[model samples]
Target: MILIVVGVIMIVTSLVSTVTTNYKKLQLQPTTESPGRDDWHHFSTGSYKLFPTEVNYEAAKNGCRNANARLVTEGIRNKVTRKSIMDEMILPAFNANKLGEGYGVWIGLDDLEVINKWKWIDGIASTNDNTAWAPSEPNNGSERCGMLHKLLKWLINDEYCLVANAYVCEIAKSK
Candidate 1:
């Protein structure tokens, strides 16, 4: 009986140590399913990070690339996803007055290559039926880059690519 009790305690101790070590490894590994960084927020679609500093559209794209992510483009497919991004990542910064003078964030949609032919960075064409655009938006042909207009209730609007704005980065889930 004494030998059995000793063996049981040893086995329990080994299991506890293994579990603790595995937990530490999991915590160290960067995961898209959870927010590993303070600025990142994980949603069902992916992990998003808001960069509150103002920068030109190109700069914003580069920043995201530097972080092993991309400017939020394909992740925002419809109203539901857009709303989730706004409520989860963008709104908190806007509510806190953390955004730049533009009061918006740069997304990956742009008509830089072809006028009025909006496409995401991944080369996916934006559908006209998408209702995320603000009223009378994408009006200025010269303003080809896309951004979420905070004053317009987080609706999308075209802006000049040269204009500086806060931007959101996303680590998309693997299909």
Candidate 2:
């Protein structure tokens, strides 16, 4: 019986080895991930502070999610911090041709189903306008896209999922 058991063990070992080899032979190489579906941004204090680019809202949100960050917004009351984010991330997000007194960066800013109750992609809720949006902004009904108004105010202007200009991305510090 011991001999039979030993023979079985040897057979199992051989089988496992054969299977492993075949698996190795069929191993697939790692493929590059697809780019964002929407515009996205990435901001890190230690890493690059600002990374802004054009993308769809969903893709932009996903990019932030992949970085383990929620979307940032004006609901955050600190004017200085929000301004820094705008200067570093939003202002420089686009090239010289893109940057202007008129055109602005689309941030994680938005007003959801709740009217005038602004929200950020980071899940912040605020009725206060701290981030800047241009005057007469946020005129669209149920529009959710947010852009820097002037410099510090967040303006609700575009549709929630509309494709727009560049965007600003922010990464929250891990608590």
Candidate 3:
């Protein structure tokens, strides 16, 4: 009886150990699946998806939100990263004529709350020196939203919020 009980206990211990190890491995796997779109590209900061279809600022925001992301913002702060996006994502879409008739791609910056005071969608203030604004940009007080202007070598430009333009969305890196 003693021998049988010891054997049963050892088997139970092994099974429990195996189960715990497998559970831990499963837990370490990524939780969020990629959005339905196929063009998601990973960067150091997060994954970005380009939406070449033309849409107004608000509609663009909604589209990104639907994909469990927000419009591209903080990630573009780094010049190298910005160039990577321009080279790998924006340029391809633009060259293929996928970005509609517009000459700009909507980003997440806007001055809706206060004219000339640009703020990202996340409510973070952006400075002129830190951003890649074009010469005489944010010039029109009537234009409250930000975009990457094709005519300006993809430099940032303030545009009318209601204007239809392509957009980029970002899924922040998991914390």
Candidate 4:
């Protein structure tokens, strides 16, 4: 009797795990089938249209800084900007890479060097405080890089800073 109960519990647990993972992966709408031209691969940061390069979090941030810019952070919760990101940033990267290609991109926010405190490379915190994951995000589990997960909605991760992947760089607008 005990053995049978244990087996049934295990089966149920496995099924639940599988269901949750699948649900997360299905959150995003599908990416574009045909990747357009290079110019169409990215979105605008203020007045400057920025492009992404394959690199880790730290390097990408540094690279952007060298050019007096910063990494792209999707802290915007507006409809227009969201649509552009869906069309430009997300779709292009999906088509150009693997299913979850380009896991590491320097966004405008991270708590790698710090903990719980996430700010953009530009030193500005997200004005929209609602752009957070489901309560207990950032896992902070030895992970030091941040990426917008393919599924899991606003779920973000922190992995090693040196881990290279595709990243979005942001340049400041001329006032």
Best by lDDT: 3
Please provide, for model 4 over 1-175, each residue's C-alpha lDDT reduced to its tens digit, 9 standing for 90 to 100.
9999999999999999999999888876576643432343333434222345667677777776665556665423334554566556655656676324455344556665576666655556644353445346667656655665555553455556676665555433421
Query: What clash count goes with each model?
Result: 0, 19, 0, 9
Which candidate should be chosen as best, given TM-score against the real structure? Answer: 3
For all predicted structures, in order, the TM-scores are: 0.75, 0.53, 0.79, 0.56
Whole-model lDDT for model 4 versus the true structure? 0.55
lDDT of 2 by residue, 24-47 (tens): 877764544534423433333322
Report the C-alpha lDDT of model 3 over 6-82, residue by residue, as the tens digit: 99999999999999999999999986675454668888878888888999999999998998899988767667668
How far off is model 2, as Cα RMSD? 6.7
Q: Least lDDT summed over 10 consecutive residues: which range in candidate 2?
A: 41-50
Poorly placed runs, candidate 4 (over 4 Å): 1-53, 66-68, 74-79, 98-101, 126-130, 134-136, 151-155
Residue 69's lDDT within candidate 3 is 92
Model 1, span 96-169: residue lDDT tens = 88886875889989988899999888777888775368888978989999998877877889999999999988
Off by over 4 Å in 1: 1-38
Q: Sort the candidates on TM-score, descending order.
A: 3, 1, 4, 2
Instruction: Please list the C-alpha lDDT of all candidates, in the order they appear.
Output: 0.83, 0.54, 0.86, 0.55
By lDDT, rank the candidates, best first. Answer: 3, 1, 4, 2
Model 1, global lDDT? 0.83
